[model samples]
Target chain A: MSAPAALQVTRADVCCVAAAEAWRGDGEIFASPMGVIPTIGARLARATFEPDLLLSDGEATFVTGTWAVGTPPVGAAEAGIAYRTVFDIAWAGKRHVMMGPVQIDRYGNANISAIGDFFRPTRQLLGVRGAPGNTVNHPTSYWLPRHTRRSFVAAVDVVCGVGYDRAAAAGPSARRFLELRRVVTNLAVLDFATPDHRMRLASVHPGVTVEEVVENTGFELVVEGEVPETPVPVEEKLRLIRVLDPHGARFREVPA
Target chain B: MQVADKRMTAEQVVAELRSGMTIGIGGWGSRRKPMALVRAILRSDLRDLTVVSYGGPDVGLLCAAGKLKRLVYGFVSLDSIPLEPHFQAARQAGTLEVSEWDEGMLQWGLYAAGLRLPFLPTRAGLGSDVMRVNPDLRTVASPYPDGEEVLAVPALHLDAALVHLNRADAAGNAQFLGPDLYFDDLYCMAAERAYVSCERIVSTEELASAGLPTQRVPRWMVHGVVKAPNGAHFTSCAPDYERDEGFQREYVAAAKDPDLWAAFVADYLGGDEEYYQKAVARRPVEVAE
Candidate 1:
């Protein structure tokens, strides 16, 4: 018989690992991840390092065990929190939601709402759903499967999620629990860790260059020195990812 | 003493609603919406309405029909289809006024209305463009030593509220057998008048025994109960049915072109609710080749 093949890591796997790292230190908080890869990442995080992280089945239940992406939660209903309770938990600053925005700026300002004027937008998207409250109340992060100049803009059309500069300007109340943790993209991972609170190039994914990231981004990113490659998932983590996404829905999101 | 029955037809409920009324609609996104009542309103001569909703096809239908003057909402999305096409078209054309609040802020506004409070202080919209977009919103400083300032989100007082549920009794005690209540009770409590349409009208004893007691929308808040089977069509009512994704796809497709939209309206929305239901039943099921 032929020997077992070596575990091959894909771009989607790297993105999942990077996305999971957003909730590395967040403990016992509700992890509301939107989209496929983010959901997979949140599940992986809960399955391994962050065991205390509460995960919802995207409808209205808190799921316990790990299940594959797109499958129904088998036994999560009995101990589920209703929609009203979800609002309460979010308001109490006990949740970290990773969202997918249409446009995001260097300052961490995101817009899932309309594009163009407030009154009459050229393209109307989902009106600021919970982005405003989520950013101002608790920790928030973002995941972009496709990192292009269009998404990583100089300025967002509408500020649904508050950035560091705007939070600072709003004073003590807005800054009370506001934390924009991380932004993971297909090309690289970014964070607002700079002194000026601008978006910094945290790390580039394997085979992706810092210059390539810069070229893709519309604004000037805070690239200090040599950017390290995003760490590949360990064997166990890769297995967990596979287990969490058996049908490979993550591949559909980030492609091969 | 006998208990009064608050049962009413969809048309009767729509007849009570006046033009330019601020109405709050229950259900989140595309799930469990009161589409039957919405269609009734569509059939009526109602115009210049200010609607408050989590928004799904109800908002899109109203926008397409030119019934809304203003819309106060957190978001309007079809869950699967991210941006609602008709809402997009209306906004792009500058046809309606909008007060876009944070989802939590909208909840707070409704809660404040239910409590009969002028406004409630919340940290949401403190630093975002929500303040800029909604210039009427004000910030209040804390009375204590910290002197912290927060946004005092004004109450979204509704003249009327419309919601859908899984079951209800004649006296208007509603129950949602679905996973989430989705703030439908809050929508009822926040309004001056509220109407609930359900998939089935069960007895009070059956309603009480069928679901958890906590899931019931008490009769005291609801003014009218309507028996509307498959009421939340296109949107999901769960247990009863899931979102009609095929129909919704047709809806989204129709919204793209004027000719297709006209054809859709002729085919689907030409007559009463019964006609619409019949048309929906007669649709050819898509079979993958």
Candidate 2:
């Protein structure tokens, strides 16, 4: 494939919100290598206004721990809690994390374990890395670099983690779960504000339309008003994702 | 009945620990955490005490001495250091009930229990047969009217969750500086009583002079506060302090070797915490080649 064009990026809140304006369902679903690597994470990070726990690490090398919200669902392996907290001490706070998954149902449920059941898992997975907590935490979200019927199936065979509805059932400590969220997809944005709490259409990506998003979705999604267009990555934001992950981990699925 | 602070001598903290009690600590790998408390816990008469953690030197040291009755963890690591033989033995023998939950579920459970909830249903168990094995976790009909099935994980409330901090005032407000926020906020809030150990007790004036007070821990939530300098030693550096790699390597080598581990433990863990300190004193300093 020919290399995509390059550009610059900055931390602008408007762009972050604009980027997620196409998000669906409480912002719990996440796709990777991100519709464009770091595009989703950076936008979400900025959208969340960089929660206290999400602050860059002390040496500015890591973030996620006592000071950071829940274990980051995104890229947190090298990340460390910037707080003066001991290992066990950090486990005691509010953490907002994001994980990339394969399937996302209307209920905001996710599947990153196996493509199918264990005996004949269509696709093997990265093991039970931490999808469980990514969903169970008070406020957890998911990302799917690809937005399609297969990726957003009616039912994920293996529910490795959670989304909006499951988090809601966890009760009181879960107050922070559903609040403050969105789901950014390659095609459009999804939300979980309705009574059923299923994935609902908010807006579509730039140059993409409602018809295109509907064609890709497997389950019936509740569509609000005439969806507006999602924000296109300003040249600069596009550049950062490309720079950090030159391979385009963000653009999960190319134009088929 | 009185909980002590990090400023309290190790002996004072040891006095509160009793046999068969469940102890919760903070840490992961051999990274950031307060090892001084672990040392104190090791010396206490606490036996068959159930332990909980995300894995690290804290769990490693406990396992090395056959002091753990049960372990609640998502994952435990002393980095290259393999887990202690006793934990492995207990796990192999089914003597120890290791309730493996997602790191988030562990936090949610603790937080749930602290809030007096019955359980926390998480997406973590969907594919895994956790519900099948741990029957306690059951699926209640999803009231969503959409017929979405879900699991109900019983709340997990520890008797106590001890944590170590970097900076704190005499009032017990603490501060953390790291990448992974292990599980301090939830655990501290959820544990019936929270114990905090800090490296320094900033003066009221110093705290008052602080710019970001939101980052500072509040005194209200803390039950007991300790001020111990270099407390993160042998565990992890508090932000600035680097990991004690040399000590970790030696411990890993020693832990995997039963004879070596036994010898080291006999001299260190086998005896009192003070004897353990003496053992520390006896170690030969590494000479640069």
Q: lDDT tens digits, residues A15-91, model 2?
A: 23444333323232221112232244544544443433333432334433221121233445343333233212223
lDDT of 2 by residue, B44-67 (tens): 667787877766778767765567
lDDT (tens digit, per residue) of candidate 1 on A47-135: 88999999887888887888888888755543577877877888899999999998999889999998998788988989998898889
Number of the top DockQ candidate:
1
Superposition error at B210 for model 2 (Å): 4.6
**For each candidate, what TM-score against the reference?**
0.97, 0.56
Q: How far is B1's C-alpha from truth in model 2 (Å)?
A: 21
Residue pairs with clashing backbones, model 1: none
Scored on chain A only, each candidate's TM-score is 0.96, 0.64
Taken over the whole model, the C-alpha lDDT of each candidate is 0.92, 0.58
Q: Model 1: per-residue lDDT, tens digit, B1-289?
A: 8798999999999999999899999998899999999999989999999999999999999999999999999899999888899999999999889999998888889989999999999998889999889999999999999879999989989999999999998999899888888889889999999999999998888987875664568988899999999999989999899999999999999999999999999998999999999999999998854
